[model samples]
Target chain A: MKNLNEISTRLEIAKKKIKKNQIKDNGTNAASLGKALKISTELVASVVVGSTIGFLLDNWFDTKPLLTICFFILGVVAGILNVIRSAKKMHKINKYRKR
Target chain B: MSLNPMHQFEVYRLGPEINLGSINLSFTNASLFMTISASVILFFLFIGTKKKSLIPSKIQLVSEMSYSFVAKMINDTAGSSAKPFFPFIFTLFMFVLFCNMVGMLPYSFTVTSHIIVTFVLASIVFVGVTIIGFIKHGLKYLELFVPKGVPVILLPLIVIIEIISYLSRPVSLSVRLFANMMAGHTMLKVFGGFVISLGLLGGWLPLGFSVALTGLEILVAFLQAYVFAILTCIYLNDALNLHH
Candidate 1:
């Protein structure tokens, strides 16, 4: 019974070690270039989307720059928020992997 | 050799043109390469699964590895509830991976480098996920745009920002893959041009750089495909789970 418990604990430790290695691999394997590309595109895409909607609405309402300006600002804010959200997620994953 | 790097991306008709009224649906190099990539994937997978021995063959191992890779990705990101989507995510990953890999060959057209192809792919994922969300949660799906706690007065602004962020998904998804592929290929071509123009003596530096860039480009190609598939899984997770 003592031998069985020792073996089981060893197995548990081995499994945990493997899990830690896997998490570390995942954290570092994603190239920084890819992350940069993903983040930059996310920011630009949000801005583009916001401005497009604003521009279309302005055309419909004949407000010219009003909606366009409003949405452009909104888009920038959204883009920053998007960047922050993704950065936080990445940070969380890294933190978990570190542990 | 053509000095113009952009010339590689030209889409000329490959055979007799097929015009549907105003629309011209002629087969082009892009179509050819896409077909090649698809057939290559089909052939590889066919061979991979043909023999079921106790010990796996190399091709079988490769196919199995890829299958498990995608399976694990979905399982991790979306959980077991997303098991039904395994085939879809697998196919998307394999197709994109094969296309990107095939494009790495000299004189081959990079299909994913084009905005239209990536855009269509992103749009499909976006639309499908939205439909799935609606089917699964009905009116509750709208709650995705609303946060848990916020002042009532500021809610509208927050909602608009959330909506804009949501709408940006497809655009970002497509742009990320397309831009990476395009930029990498263009850089490789530019370096190749530099190697030629610089001649034997000066060419060595650019040639070395080109070799390294090729290695990096191959990595980028694989990374972009993985990113594309993983993003799809993440979006699918959002739809299925409805978690903010």
Candidate 2:
């Protein structure tokens, strides 16, 4: 019984250690997830906003689809800009973490 | 009664339906779940923080961890400038987290699954951040649409690009949360229906997948909440610090 108790206590301590490591891993994982999701959403959102604004402007100015087309192109560019900016932000965070 | 995956998202009126003006102001399952989630958060926090013992109980530990987690997140993302907005951000995080979590329970409505709901939340943050920026910097807040260190010739193009990106914040934020919750729950329900349809021997495979999917969805629920809060902090950082 004494030996069994010692082994169980050892097991419990080991389990606790593993749990701590897992928690650390999860923190890093969540951070990376936040980065990845932010980039994707930023990409889509810029385009959507760009196109909507352009379309509305075209309607108001009686320009038909001209402004819409121009804005859509601009939106794509903006989306890429967003992705780059978010990537840079993430990179900066990683550098800070290292220090 | 039918094993339809889409049925889970249907908004049904609960109790007396009230109409004010031309708008339908009926209490819905969505509203009920929202109330439930809010109450659950309050109840949990109330009970958890009640015991301030030195040797902390389980509830106290959870409460403390959540407090520290949001505190740390705000500090890391927004720095000291966002100290004033801590309560609002914390409440947003907890509300969304609870809504996502409570929805994971069977037969519960997922309030975050609706685009309108998430969009409203996102819009509030967007408008609030914009207002803060203007209040802090006056007309200079428009400077946010212009990134630092761009060549003179590229100023107009870059400004437009930045403005477009700025306008997209709420759209992306709301859609990301709404789509993630809706997609995960729908997939879970679909797989669940398959498990039921294919009984005994055949059902085992789908049952296993459903189990795995549930685990993934739970992670997603937490991650989406984190993403929402962190993004808000980042936006707050921009408004507060004017980081280009």
Candidate 3:
């Protein structure tokens, strides 16, 4: 009975240790690279989407370059905002993991 | 060896071409590799879980590890409310992962490298999540576009920005995976061409770089799949919890 209790306690400790290592792994080198990759694409994609919408609206409204120019600026803002938002979220996750 | 690096990305039909009016449904190398990866995943899981034991075999250990990894990811990101989507998220992860890993082989075609394929997958997620948000929150789902503390004066611009960001989800999701895979493979092929062209004396440098790059590409293959799945989870969380 004593041996069984000791083994159970050891197993619990081992499980906790593994969990901690996994959490730490989340913030490691490759994971950071993944986050970097995601941010770049997010930035570019939003700009592309914004400009496409603007261009389409312009074509429909016969406004030519007017809506396109407006949306291009808006797209740039949206892209920067996206990068900041995702960066903040990542920072939060990393800080939480550290604890 | 084809000197042109872009030659590897060329899609050629394997069997007789099947054309349905303007649309071609022929079995190409991309389709073949996709089928191969799907079968490989199916076989791995089937055999892995065929027998249950206290001490699992190597295959079972790997299979179980993947299952738990995805489960934990969902739990952490989407919480318990997202439990029902586990099967979908798991399948998406495994499919993308296998497609990527299989593509790492010498002659295998990468299905996900194509923008169309990844776009379709991302569209499914985007559309499904939107439907789910509407079903769960009804008209209130439109509130997702409205910021909480924004002044009424800036609300219109903010809402437009929000909508643009929302629409970009599928684009970003699809482009990220497709671009990563395509760029990595193209770089690898370009370096390989360098190795061949440089000859025995000068080839050692690019050859060494290729070896290092192959290792990096494998890591990237795994990482991109992981990113893809986790993003899906994050999107699902937004729909389910409406935490934005």
Candidate 3 chain A, poorest ten consecutive residues by summed lDDT: A19-28
Interface RMSD of each: 1.1, 1.2, 0.6
Q: What is model 3's DockQ versus the real complex?
A: 0.80
Number of the candidate with higher TM-score, 1 or 3: 3
Error of 3 at B13 (Å): 1.7
Rank the candidate models, highest TM-score first: 3, 2, 1
Ranking according to DockQ, highest score first? 3, 1, 2
lDDT of 3: 0.93
**lDDT per residue as tens, model 1, B78-194:** 899999989889989998999999999998999999999999999999999999999999999999999988999999999999999999999999999898899999999999999
Instruction: Assess candidate 3 and give its TM-score to the true structure.
Output: 0.93
Chain A TM-score by candidate, in order? 0.70, 0.73, 0.74
Q: CA lDDT of B26 in candidate 2?
A: 96
- Stretches off by above 4 angstroms in model 2 are A1-24
lDDT of 2 by residue, A75-95 (tens): 999999889988888889889
Evaluation by DockQ, superior candidate among 1 and 3: 3
Could you list the CA RMSD of all candidates, in the order they appear? 4.9, 4.4, 3.0
